[model samples]
Target: MAAAVFLVVVVVGIVSAVVAMSHRSPVVNVLSLVVTLFCVAASYALLGAEFLAAAQILIYAGAILVLFLFVVMLLNAPEEQRPKEPRPFQRAVGLLLALLAGVGGVAVLIGIEVVAPAARVSGDARAIGRLLVGPYIFAFEFISVVLLAALVGALVLVKRKH
Candidate 1:
């Protein structure tokens, strides 16, 4: 039953993500992304990582989706104004990339089944904390600095616009 549910969640996530990517309307895309994120959170819950699941719902579905909506509103993007005909060259390239992605996804699924127990132990917060404070400490600090810069840059942009 768990396996069946997991399969269903995976399918929903994939379908929603594809919708999010392929939609022309910014609002539709953002809502679709939120659905995809919700599916991911549900999958995490089914997999016994309640903390991760909650974080996914709270941080991604709540905060990130709100951020995406804010960006869409701030941009004041126009509605879909697509060309009447799709380019064959671009279609061919897109198909090729999609095929490659499918193959890569399958490989990843198989690899997950064979991953060492130690790698699978990342479901716990302490393990994640250790990773952040250990080998990934530099990356953690770097991202904080980057985020700070981004916030300052956004403030500067707003000030200039006023």
Candidate 2:
């Protein structure tokens, strides 16, 4: 049952990612991305990473996706922008870069051996707080700053046009 649920979440995540990438409308794409984030959070929950799941839902699905949708609506972006075909050279370069990334990821995965799951931690909130403040302190602060900048930029852009 757990395995089936995990599989379903993974499949949904993949489908949502594909939809997000392939959708022509920005609003639809953002909605698809939110769906993807939700699936990711579900996966995290299944893996017993409750704190991570909540963070994924709160930060990515709630805050970031909402901001994306708001910006798209505020700009009144067109539903169907003309797609640009990449030049041959650009396409070749992109393919090469993608291949390199794929190879690197495969190599890393092969090098790292999977470990069995440890006992699940209780007090998820406290654990997450400690984790964020310890090794991930810089990342937490960086994200906060980035979010602040995005908010300020959005306000400035909207205000100037008004």
Candidate 3:
């Protein structure tokens, strides 16, 4: 039962991610990404990492998604207009590339051999917190700085357009 649910969550996550990337409208992309993020959280819960699941929902689904929506609205980004007629040549080339990529991915997967299983690590909140503040503290701080810079850039762009 758990495996079945996990499979469903993973499928939904993949599908939603594809939808998010394929959409032209920013609002549609955001909505699809929300679905994808929620599915990811569901996947973590299914894998018994409840702490990670909760964090995924709270951080990515709640805070980051809201921030994305705010950025979309602030920028007043318009939906891209689709071409009146589809280009068959472009579609054919894209299809051929996609097929080639799929073949390469399958070949790589088949060629790879695992010597030994990786060590299982704890996913508890305390352990994660400790790791965040421990040797990875610089990485954590760097991410925060990057996010801050992005927010500042967004505000500047908004102001400049006026």
Candidate 4:
């Protein structure tokens, strides 16, 4: 049952990601990205990482996706500006590269030995908090700084446009 739910979420996330990347309208792309994020959160939940699932929804789906949509709306970029198709040569090259990468990834996965699951610490919010503050402190601080910079940059850009 959990595996079935995970599979569905994975499929949805893939479709949403493709739609987000291929869409011409910024608004629609942002909406698709939000859907992708939500599906990923659901996948995390199905994997028993409830804390990560909640954080994924709260941070990416709720905050970042909303910010992206707000920026897209504020910019009011015309749909016509988006490229509908790549050059033929670019498309060919991209396809060839994708095929090569996929082949290599499959080979690597097939070569890996299966391992039994190790005993895991309970993944409660408290455990997550401890890990974040201890081992991932630098990453946490770095992300906060990056977000702050992005906010300042957005404000500056909007101010200049007005």
Clashes of each: 0, 0, 0, 0
Q: If scored against the real structure, what TM-score would every candidate get?
A: 0.70, 0.75, 0.74, 0.79
Off by over 4 Å in 4: 81-92, 135-158
Pairs that collide, model 1? none
Candidates in order have lDDT scores of 0.88, 0.89, 0.89, 0.87
- Error (Å) of candidate 4 at residue 64 is 0.9
By TM-score, rank the candidates, best first: 4, 2, 3, 1
Q: Taking the tens digit of each residue's C-alpha lDDT, what string does model 1 give over 7-68?
A: 89899999999999888999999999999998989888876677788889999989989998
Better of 1 and 2 by lDDT: 2
Residue 140's lDDT within candidate 4 is 86
- Candidate 4: tens digits of C-alpha lDDT, residues 1-162: 877887888899999999999988889999998999899888777667889889999989888889888888888888957457799999999999999999999999999998997766566799888988999999988999998998999778769543
TM-score of 2: 0.75
Clashing pairs in 3: none
| CA displacement after TM-score superposition, residue 114 of candidate 4 (Å) | 2.2
Question: What CA RMSD would you report for each candidate?
Answer: 3.8, 3.4, 3.2, 2.9
